[model samples]
Target: MKYKSFAVAIWGVVILLVILVPLPTVLMDILFILNITISLLVLLNAIYAKDALSMSSFPTLLLFTTLYRLALNVAATRLIIGQGDAGKVVESFGEFVGGNNIVVGAIIFLVIMLVQFLVITKGAERVSEVAARFTLDAMPGKQMAVDADLNAGLINEAQAKERRKNIQREADFYGAMDGASKFVKNDAIFGFITVILNIIGGFIMGMMQNSGASWNDILEKYTKLTIGNGLAVQIPALLISVATGIIVTRAASDEELSEEIISQLFTGPKTMFVAAGACFLLTFIIGRFFMIIVAAFLVFLGIRMQDSEQEKIKQDEKEMEERTVEEIRKPENVVTLLHVDPIELEFGYGLIPLADVNQGGDLLDRVVMIRRQLALELGMIVPVIRLRDNIQLNPNQYVIKIKGVEVAEGELLLDHFLAMNPGTAEEEIEGIPTTEPAFGLPALWITESQRDRAEMLGYTVVDPPSVISTHMTEVIKRHAHELLSRQDVQTLLDNVKSSYPAIVEELVPKQLSLGEVQKVLCNLLREGVSIRDMVTILETLADYAPVTRDTDMLTEYVRQALGRAITKTFITPDNSDVITLDPQVEQLILDSVQKTEAGSYIALEPSVSNKIMQNLLKLVEKVAQLGKQPIVLASPVVRLYFKRLTEQTIPGLVVLSYNELDPSVKVRSIGMVTCS
Candidate 1:
């Protein structure tokens, strides 16, 4: 293994020597043979490769081989023009391959050069250029596909990473080939020029050195050697050119090139019989015995192939029947149906264009972006959203589902723009009025011609795709807690464990079980907190886990630990308007608290609970009147109980604890919720 590199280094050294130093004909002959062998091997390897990436280094190899061949050409030129004798390889090629006739040898050399330079090299170069361009263009779509698969849990992180790496490798390989192809192209040009210079220079040198030789004698001798040298070098170059063409044009397949060609070509036995009949008819004019034999062989092959194909089809059908019967008999087959997707978007047939890429529907791309947006905002991976067409719905209607149950549904005017009055619109647009599905704000679905006028009047305009994407994004945020499972928590833990090993090692399994950790994280997500900072959450859990395994209490500690983030969420720098809980009301809630093995809750009488609810509702409405969100501020101990008390009656309300606020933020108590 160590000497392998040493041997390659020596090969490079030898090429350099051939270019710069004069060498013996014996060494020239050997190097000439080596070049031919390498070229043939490269051609064979290219043919056998299952895919272009299998020979990713071929582009670089193309450069080395071109240089090596050119170096040999220079040495052969030196021997021919300066000494009038290149080598045995050149001499034999000139005499034997050329049939000892200058015209024949020259014709043979020209034919090889033209075929390689014009046909194979030209086509390979063009293919390389196109392949490189297309491969680079497709990279982003391929990367997103991997991400979609990973998010859907179809593949793990490691597999996703490997796929991404391969995508990069493929792009890099094609790009290099695009440039390396020029080497072969220019090599052919240089070979032609070298041959021309060699013939003219050899002729002049031969005549000048051999003073007694006639012009005919000099021309025949030098031309034969020159043609021979060109033939030997051009044959290998032709092989390499063919290899370049084969590699760049090869698509990924399970079988080698030869096998794929044979299988695909002979797929229809009927075509073979038709070709045999044509050949048999041609025998009358072209050849009698020869064409008859060719036609007979084709007929025999076709008959055998047709019989084999029929038998294979019968065997396949029998196996498929047996498999189907076995599957139907097994009761365990029902287990597959029990699994449900975490999220799904089903639309009517008329709205299929929105999810179809062929029709310019960017809905699938938008779904991928929605997953990314939620991951960034909530610090958790969003589940893959399944998109399917549902026939039972209205033409323009779509429904969003969580765990196989519909939670939200909306309708769209596919060819119109959704324009919402941002409260500053100069005038109402003339269009069909509707409510924005995401936030339930009043909007108008205006035609394309009315879009500019709507925007000019200060309305917020969005397309149909954006409407659904925004709605889906908001829904995912609201129910992110439900979508997160124990498995998701473990995945998150495994991700951060690499950077914060001690925090995770000290906190999970030892301090709290996976389910307990999952509950605490779920609680945070339920209240809308970004858990992107896993280190802090785990550290807080480790510190408070031993004292209380109560998830609700542990969540409170985690909130306080993430106080800065929580403060940023609710408290703006200029205005922090919040309703405060009265000390007496807080004391009353504490007094009515009840605890059980399951958990704790308030055991207050209905009348007492009703009074607190009425006061809280009045305060919440009062804050809304001031053009600010209604946030209830309470002491750390009373915050959780108050939130639970009001959450069902007043959903989407913001509740915060005093400890969860950063010390730098100032709070203004707009109103107080009290049971006086």
Candidate 2:
């Protein structure tokens, strides 16, 4: 650390000297000696420490030092002389000015340019690190809380954890890559411009001398040049630094750095110096004191910008907090049932637990009672229902078998049924209503075959018509309640409905056509819907005479109905499941795949799937020719196919499923663990 700091300090002093002095032969010799000494020390320290010497600070220091050396040379020759022999020196000076000024100026400009380039490049690296740190810090325990909730069965653990990890890893990788790429490109482009500026400055200086201006006159004229011109060279450097700072800071909030702003900062300095005479006139009266005032104003601007940025950050944080609070407080009309083992239920899938069934029963009872009240007003019959003793899974799907009927099919519907009570808009079913009047109702039907199967399982079926009537009423009431309660929810529903009418009203007989309604309905279906209510609504729409005959009208109506059903089922469940996977998992998988391709069969440490192992082997086969090697498959719950393959002793297929692999393999695996 001490050595590194020393190297940086030496570099800084060199830059300071160059900025304050000019490059004479003596000064150049002195600079060469200084550079050699510092370079040797840096190399020695790097060798001793067994680390790469930081290349980041070198260019900036070198450039500034060159500038100071050049300045000193220019000032000495221009500003000092005796009266009589001064003319002889002046002629010598003119020769030097004509021939050497451009070269010296170019050298100084090149150095400063290089320094700026290095600063941008290295600064980006530092910025990326800061960005990653800030992003990690900004989470404020949210990820941990999400993990805890998942573990506690408040959410789906596997899916949520996977998603969370994915999100974090993606964010980290993108942030680092973006920062690095952007900075490198900007640095290169700016460095090129600096080279051009140096060439221009050299040309201008040579021109002044060729016009017979004395060194003293040139110096006096320089002093008279505008403060803006004096600042022009340094302004690009300052602006670039400020931009780098902003880019680094913005990454904390996950916002992107603007390329336009960076470009403006780089180009602004050169453009400012286009009219040197005008700048000189302004500088003569205002002098350096005015430059000082501008500097002070810039400092003030920096302070104000910092304060504004900080306040904006605070406001955003406050809003996020409020949103989080609102989400937590938002009434959950649905209660999720988890750890469902579809295999146990004898359904093709899995079974939800007995405890979840009991909770479902209680919720069902409340919904039924609400439906009964609503049905009385609608002149519909209310079903008298009793919760059955035995729970059976629907053979066709992992649906809950109540009495003889499948309460819900599909993972999506089952999830909704478990989480939401009937009569809540939050749990509306999705997707089935567009093509058929039965919509999602078929999913809830208790077929005669299903009833007989349920009876064998020690359950009895309730009357179908009564159950359907009661269910429909409950669903409607729930939807109405939700629409009345939530502003955002209501707005979304209204938005979908409003689009068709507005389209018709504005473009009737002109651009508005039946196609517009179809488009609107398609959009709504894609969004999501309540399958249960959608089926009922579609049936009701069929009964309405006006919608029954015209295919276009029916198409639009069906589409909207399907959308409503889909909305109820998909939207509610999605909101509740917000877990994301760690990025390392994907990176690890990708790296492992890459290595295996390079003639090495690699075993992945225990993780999410058997697929990762398969991918590793595939990658190895693609990259190199290897004889059949025992590719160990290490993960929890070894697949039956893998076990069978291992037992057969098949060539190119040796599967060892265990947590502890051999030491040699373990070392190899470390190389496969990727970092972005």
Residue 205, model 1: Cα distance from true site in angstroms: 55
Candidate 1 lDDT over residue span 407-428, tens digit each: 9999999999999986778987
| Predictions in order: lDDT | 0.91, 0.38
Local accuracy of candidate 2 as per-residue lDDT tens digits, 241-329:
43333434332222123444454453432233333334455566777556545555555555665667689899999999999887777
The alpha-carbon lDDT assigned to residue 331 of candidate 1 equals: 98
Candidate 2 residue spans exceeding 4 A from truth? 1-5, 12-236, 244-249, 253-400, 403-676
In candidate 1, which residue pairs clash? Answer: none
Q: Provide the lDDT at 532 for model 1.
A: 84
